[model samples]
Target chain A: AAGVIQSPRHLIKEKRETATLKCYPIPRHDTVYWYQQGPGQDPQFLISFYEKMQSDKGSIPDRFSAQQFSDYHSELNMSSLELGDSALYFCASANQGLYNEQFFGPGTRLTVL
Target chain B: DQQVKQNSPSLSVQEGRISILNCDYTNSMFDYFLWYKKYPAEGPTFLISISSIKDKNEDGRFTVFLNKSAKHLSLHIVPSQPGDSAVYFCAATVYNQGGKLIFGQGTELSVKP
Candidate 1:
């Protein structure tokens, strides 16, 4: 079973505060992806990491940043969170294959007050 | 700038009936397609997939049909069950794009007993 584990299944924070979310990819997977899912909307790509280096980032605000560690764990940081920043964050991982399947973790729901 | 679209916001089906979910993409570069299902408070899970090389691919009760010429895809679930009630999102990846997937606005499916 391919499973990605995410920390803080639910979170609440005040506006202007910083929030950090963590994701641990499935073992043996080299790629990790972060996405933001707003209310009543589809999930949008945030960034992707491969081999400990940042590969790509979507059109997100500069306040959003991510890091991939040597152990293949990734963290997403939001600086100065706004009310609009409240949403569900999902982490996905896949191995090295052209047609590799990406598996997801139960998302972290952030509610900015 | 929404590349993928799922016009329907929700669907209701009787148990044991077939449920069909559709998706369309404006990008011709998208060659790989996937369907994901998400239960409440859970991240999306891979349900099925189809490559551009084939028009249809089936796994057990789930089948995905891809029409490259039309730049469209559909997922069919046979004998839908109450457990299948969830939000379904259709995703597409460009060939050799490091498995980055762009998703469509999800459709909520409700199966009646």
Candidate 2:
């Protein structure tokens, strides 16, 4: 079965730079979620979208923004990046249902220098 | 505040034995819970899940038990094998509410042969 896909499996950036991460959810899946896992820390919820519309928000920083396109794919844009932004960014997708099981992608490892 | 917590950081189990991982949550609004297994450098893979209305859910050698009253859940793996050594995470979310999952810190399980 096709799984979620994320671009730039690994990224390196400098302080105050801008970066954009893209995600292609499983075919026909309508929900997309973003999470960040820092070194030695649990994955933290960032934001989510349902059917190309913003649905819920979590601990996402002000410098970060995300949107789901009409194709059901999503993108996370980060500006003025800080060293603390370094972490593993994951994207997950699921079909909206009563007991939905999310499928995750390989994840993008961001290293801010 | 940490809503979901896995008190045990790591556990070592002998082959052919049983491995049990526990999780606790403070939010009562979460209606769906799931367990995911993850290997290094890979995204989380769906293992099993239980809804608030169900107390137990089983799949093959993996079983998940939920106690709504105590806001706790556990995952059991019977006849464990060395291949089961990895990190397991407990996650929860409100049904039909954007599907943003809140994850626990995770427990590392080592199954020795």
Candidate 3:
């Protein structure tokens, strides 16, 4: 089975720079979710989309923005990045009518200096 | 306030023994639950799950139990193997709430051979 795919498995950036992460959800999956995991902490919800529409928001920073394209792939764009933004970013996908099992992709490790 | 919590930071178990991981949640509105296993530098892999309506669900050597009254859930891995050593996370979602998952701080499980 095809799993969710995320780009830039690892990233290094300086403070105040901009970064964009992309996610390709499993084929035919309609919902995409983004999460951030700090060292030794639980994965924190960032934002989510369903069928290219904004579905929900969590603790995502004001500098961060995301959108799901018509192809069902999602992108997270971060501007004026800060050191505190260093963490593992993950993307997950699920089918709504099939119930709730969201399959996650290999995360992108972002290190901001 | 942390809605989902894994109180134990780590656990060690002998190979071939049963490994149990516990998770608690303060949110009674959560209706779906899941367990995920993660290795270093990788995304979480879905393991097992039990819904709020089901007390138990099993798949091969893995089982998940849910106690709605206590807002608690547990994952049981029988005859654990060294390969099973990894970080395990517990997550929950409200059925009607956009399918965003609330994750617990993961517990590291070491299965010694």
Report model 2's chain A TM-score: 0.97
- Enumerate the candidates' DockQ scores in order: 0.69, 0.76, 0.78
The segments of candidate 3 whose C-alpha lies over 4 angstroms from its true place after superposition are none
Most accurate candidate by TM-score: 3
Candidate 2 lDDT over B5-81, as tens digits, reads 99999999999999999999999888889899999878899999888899999999999999889998999999899
TM-score of each: 0.96, 0.97, 0.98
Global lDDT of each model?
0.90, 0.92, 0.93
Show the lowest summed lDDT stretch of 10 residues, model 1 chain A: A93-102
lDDT of 2 by residue, A1-113 (tens): 89999998999999999999999999999989999999888888899898898888999999999999999999999999999999999999998773359999999999999
| Model 1 lDDT tens row, A1-113 | 65899999999999999999999999988889999899888888888899888877886789988999999999999999999999999999987484347898899999999
lDDT of 3 by residue, B1-113 (tens): 88899999899999999999999999888888999999988999999877889999999999998988888889999989999999999999986888899988899999999
The DockQ score of candidate 2 comes to 0.76
Cα lDDT for residue B105, candidate 1: 93
lDDT of 3 by residue, A52-72 (tens): 999999999999999999999
lDDT of 2 at B6: 99
